[model samples]
Target chain A: MASKGTVSVEVSDLRREFKGKGSPVVALDGVSLKVGQGEIFGVLGPNGAGKTTMIRILSTLLLPTGGWAKVMGFDVEHEPEKVRRVINMASGAEKAGYDFISAKKNLWFFSQLYGIPTATAEKRIMELSEMLGLTKYLDRKFYALSTGYRQRATIARAFVNEPKVVFLDEPTIGLDVMTARSIREFLKEQARRSERTIILASHNMAEVEAICDRVAIIDKGKIIAAGTPEDLMRSLGAPALVMEVSPPQSGFEMLSRVEGVKGFTASTEEERGLSTVHIVVETDAAARAAEDAVKREGLKVVASWRKQATLEEVFVALVGRGFKEREEQDVV
Target chain B: MKARALVRLWSIFGEPLWIVVSMGFPVLSSLALSLLYYSIGAASYVGFAVLGGVMVSFWGNVLWSMASQFYWDKQEGLFEIYLTSPAPISAILIGMSVGGIIGTVPSALIVTGIGWVLFHPAVNAVWGGVILTFGLTLASLYAMGMTLSSLYLAYGREAESLNEVLQEPVSMLSGLYFPSLGARSPFPLAIQAAASLIPLTIGMDALRKTLFYGNDIWQVWPDLAILGVMAVVLLFASTYALKYLENVGRRDGTIGVRIR
Candidate 1:
């Protein structure tokens, strides 16, 4: 992958098990993948899918129970010190700064831990804070900052050392849309500007599609699919069609009976007296056939369009369930 | 590393009001105990009470700064960040211990000054031996505290309760307020022997003998040797315990967050 030295991270059959309440729970089982230098790699998974566990192991924060992982060519288990020196990670699970200290001081403290020179650290902190829209909040106590600012500061802290490899686990989980978009853009710019290898683990499919150069869909501690977004979408071998209808008729059996229309799901907006149907079809002709089938059902077709399969569709096709549904099931 | 340690010390004692209250509490407590000794016709024992106050202040530093730091760090997510960093865990612990000492030094000095002025105990003109004894006592006490911290690191909030549980008993058993020996002493020989096993007991005894009784270095060699051995043993034990617990914590996934 990427001709040896160009490979920034290489994981092989990496395994980790947690001592569950009554039995051993496998968080990761024989998960293997490789990421090249300067690549923006996205890891997609449902709840309990081992994405954070994999990031933790690779970042040298947790040791794997079996197999191996390497970061920047250093074995994570055997040469953890070297690996740690070259990497940093940001996670949404926990806030990562001293609550009593100012944001600047917190970054300074971490920079000292990384042995960054004071002058360089100061310049880097200013640059990152300015870029992340955190300059005004830099003097404020970390606990006093809002959630978005805190998340941004944590991201800035991770980048303070200009690490060769960075792991971001749901870095934008609870942010507002604008904040999340800004962070996504910043991550992309950083990856492009520095040629940094960034592994982003997130549940947001659109975010991944917008920023990731390549992605791996993980389910049940296994990498079920890995490729560029285009490659994965192309593998589905069909396009998706969206049709908006009024009066919310549900006679979609005719659409499925059509020659090229594979299947469709209809959702009604009762308050608005409208229904939107998503149909999977082999071609544009199938979409027209589905529209005709809907018209034959006496439902007024407002509009219809054929679109390429989305990453969400590809994920569902591979995993057999929608991400939110799987997440809800996990909660149950 | 040095700057980081200084920052830690500053965080603990940076506020003027906090420094006054923290240092004032031990000094005032020691003065109260000294006045009680004077009222009981044991005015000469005022120095003992003052020394006990210094040891209490030291205990506070150990409990909050060295021991409970693990819990606080985990709560603040600093422990996970520290683990993922290239810095050695020992370095962080050492920085914390050094900061603790720095934060407690003012209280210690104020108590020592009050004792020296109040009792003017028959001073060991040999200042070198007295200083060595004081230094060793602090080191041995810190080493023991560090060993206890390793156990508390696994105990989480229970460590706070244990800190309360330990305060007075350790002082009493260490002869902090009164001598554990001599004909007038109430403690049995076996009890004194058991108390002597505690580094603070031996350290306090050696300090009192050298500083108050004017004992020579040779005369206090036995206590010093015992303290030296205890310090080494506790330091080694604490180091091993920390490494073992860290590995167990990693396996259990408990190091990054609170277990309870």
Candidate 2:
């Protein structure tokens, strides 16, 4: 439960397991969190981090294998209908509605599912379309709309029901920079009203940092850390260290083994023979040690500098591995 | 229900080309039976075959449009949304069935129109029996469709294959081209008993009594009773089955995972 304010969502030790080819795979392992009414909560995780799984459960689309969750004071498992009535969810990767119909028709179709009156739904659709820059494309067939517009249409559909709580899973993923920012601003504006709570699960660190009131970092089906973004970043203590090497090198696993190198990411520009290494450190001494370690590995560091702290750094500091590295690591 | 029904309506009426092509269905069904009977030197039975063709067409639409539609919706990602809404899954399905009936009626009429032109089967205008039997048959058949819809919802592509597997054999089993239950049928007792299990078979058998022989509602009350019972039981079973199978899908983590 939330420590302050009116609690809108209460989750306790929620566990979800999927049957694997040889063994069961745990998708959500003992997740618990609370979002107070009118708070914007962000869940930060890499691909396949059980963020979507949690949102799916909260929205009453999936039942938990264990534990329990309550949305708007109704148990998700026992009173799913009640939960559904109060909450709505949107996934960035989802494709919906009939492709043959216009985007407006599709929105109208979904609005009717919630039994929204036609006039009210139409007014909402118009407002959302204009807000999302989808007004011009509303008449186009869904199959004809661009991916960005289609995603915008989907977001509009999510809001047409006027849900008390909305779950957005990577809502701006794969969007253009401007569109993503606009969507962020839109969500931020919605949160500003303090009339509803928004729970968004995203892999984009900046997005979470920019819009979330509080954040939780999840990986390997577990919440590794949770707190305000500033508090979490301050927990790392040292500024992130970035090293540029003219000749890119592989085998970044060695850096993780180095003392003081909490977690480091190595991206190679092989054709350009350059690599950028972003390292999270516990102290200034660790940043210096990471620089030394890079040189000892026979990769000449052309330049080194400090960068602003981010959720990625927090994830690295907490798990001792970068998001990309941990995500690539196999989980059963 | 209205939402799904509207989508159903649009999809059915979307392409003028498909609509034009769909009109060929009843003609082909009616013509094939008439020709088959004529070829077998059993031209007198062509009336039975003509009427059989119409029922078979309705059954076919129930399979393709109503039964398999849930799988299509899941693939399109609407089923998850439906699951999350306050709207009952059964309502969506019932809506689809209602739309499917509307979409199917024109073709059914075309077949019946052909029936009058070629076979001239007796329809002594027992309007009450005819409408009641027609209505119950649709209700029971759609309820049976709702059962298949549950299977399609959870099993995905496997249950879709059942649509194809069910098409022709069901027509044969239901005796859509012949009477299966009476001594008039060539099949053995075991076959007749098996055919009786299909609601379409019962509905069509009842339809034949009323449409071909112009039997009154009193004369064919037993078949109506069976169809009514079947509708209620299947509808009840389907309602529970939809919920149970959806839960199974959720437990398996397969509900929202789309696959070919």
Candidate 3:
């Protein structure tokens, strides 16, 4: 990892509330974090997690109602113009640029918004297109490009200005798995090579785990967990117990009685009646005790394993619920 | 960049298809209306129909290309990027008005040229007064557009509803004041009085005074001065209104239409 020296983005107790029809909706309630220069910081959250709100505020697109945010030492509210000059954002599936124009023209047009000269902007556009695998599609009209190509072009436009800070809101969304992986690799490489600070907002756990230097897990408009992925999972200090069992209905009753178990959830398949029950136990003895109890309950322990904790488990550990249990948090 | 793009549009497309459409509507309406004058043997007043068509083009351009453009930008998601850029939204909008005027001028000129060719309305224009009137009208009209653009972006649909009213067309209606003014304009005295208060109406009245009546700059100076003042005032209003509306967007957390 590159030296994380200076603070590229400093957000402190940033509050943004939307006036809801019935009442006000608070999107970011005192959310605070600092992203160091050259770090790929990830804001991970389920739907309506206020990830986009933070990105928008940091990008100077939307204003914060209370608290304050700064990008590259410029206050996002008071010095938005300076912040905008240093930062750029690309959102997944954003319908930006003129459809009638080519992707190259679109990139050039946006670069002009930042006052980039024509020759320099063109050179940068070519470089970005090449990096993003969009060179061939550069001359094609934006509306004609495939979704993957269009998304690549959008991402390229974000980087055209060589902005010091880049905000990518779900940048890999709606892409094929291979494309998503390649984009992630490219972003990782770009951040390292250029020493650029990237603030990525995504819901993909594995992607965040793989690329992010540090991750913040936001739920219900608040950050529940923030640290290195390994550190976060390790901090759980619990091994997850995965079991596949037939006739598992009665076995859950016995397993719940096992000590040292922090939390457990089960998924029963209808056709096979095989249940995949995930148990978070405080110790290895708890896993063994739970397995033996399932066997004593006349349930077939088809398969079982004690695995290292994941961010999902860490989320469950902290929130006392999995990501899927929450309702969609509407954004402003 | 937008200016160059428009110049490119002019190059490839030959004045844009809208020029034909915008020019066509006015030319046709003016020709049909002028029949009212010829029928009553008041042919001398055909300049009213001719000049009215010409000025209406600028007003229409202001209404759509300037005022309601933000709504379209928001709907298309372009406004999001615009909002994030280093250049403030107001600067871009004012720039757009410049480009829109560039794109709209050909149609205005074409209308004027055609009106001159067909009707031959004799004009002993006071060149100084004419230039001042035309220049102030353009400035004030576009400044008004800037103000509308800001207010509309702030209020969203409520201001968007006003976009349906096409152009400041009262100049054409006030032609009814001349018994032999060629067209049978439907404007009542109340509307004419109210319309007279607007900058466009004042500018157009000044333009007619200079163009047809051959009034000197001193004769039309008051209208020119009012237009100059209106231009400055509206320009300032546009900036303040935008700032106020943006604060509203922040408070409401909507950005007035964050992403369509």
Q: Quick one: best lDDT, which candidate?
A: 2
Candidate number of the best TM-score: 2
Candidate 3, A315: how far from true, in Å?
2.1
Docking class of 3: acceptable
lDDT of 1 by residue, A215-303 (tens): 99988788889899898889879888888998886445676578876555567888878888777777778778878888988888888
Off by over 4 Å in 3: A1-3, A20-24, A238-308, A328-332, B1-24, B35-42, B158-160, B166-190, B256-260
DockQ of 1: 0.46
State which candidate has the highest DockQ: 2
Best-to-worst ranking by lDDT: 2, 1, 3
List model 2 lDDT by residue over B1-260, tens digit each.
Answer: 87787777786687677566666776687788888888888866777777776777679778988788788888887888888888898898888888888877777778878777876654555778978998999999999998888877766568667887998888888888788778787889998889888899888888778876779999999999999999999898889998998787767767788886
Which stretch of 10 consecutive residues in model 2 chain B shows the poorest summed lDDT?
B118-127
Interface RMSD of candidate 3, in Å, is 3.3
- DockQ-based CAPRI category assigned to the predicted complex of candidate 1: acceptable
**lDDT score at residue A265, model 3, on the 0-100 scale:** 62
Please estimate how well model 2 matches the true structure, expressed as its whole-model Cα lDDT.
0.84
Candidate 1: stretches off by over 4 Å: A1-5, A21-23, A239-308, B110-126, B181-185
Tens-place lDDT digits, model 3, residues A191-306: 89998899999887888899999999998778878999999989978779899999746236566578876666667787887988777788889888988888887788999988
| Candidate 3 chain A weakest lDDT stretch, 10 residues | A323-332
What TM-score would candidate 3 get against the native?
0.84
Model 3 scores what on Cα lDDT?
0.77
| lDDT agreement with native, every candidate | 0.81, 0.84, 0.77
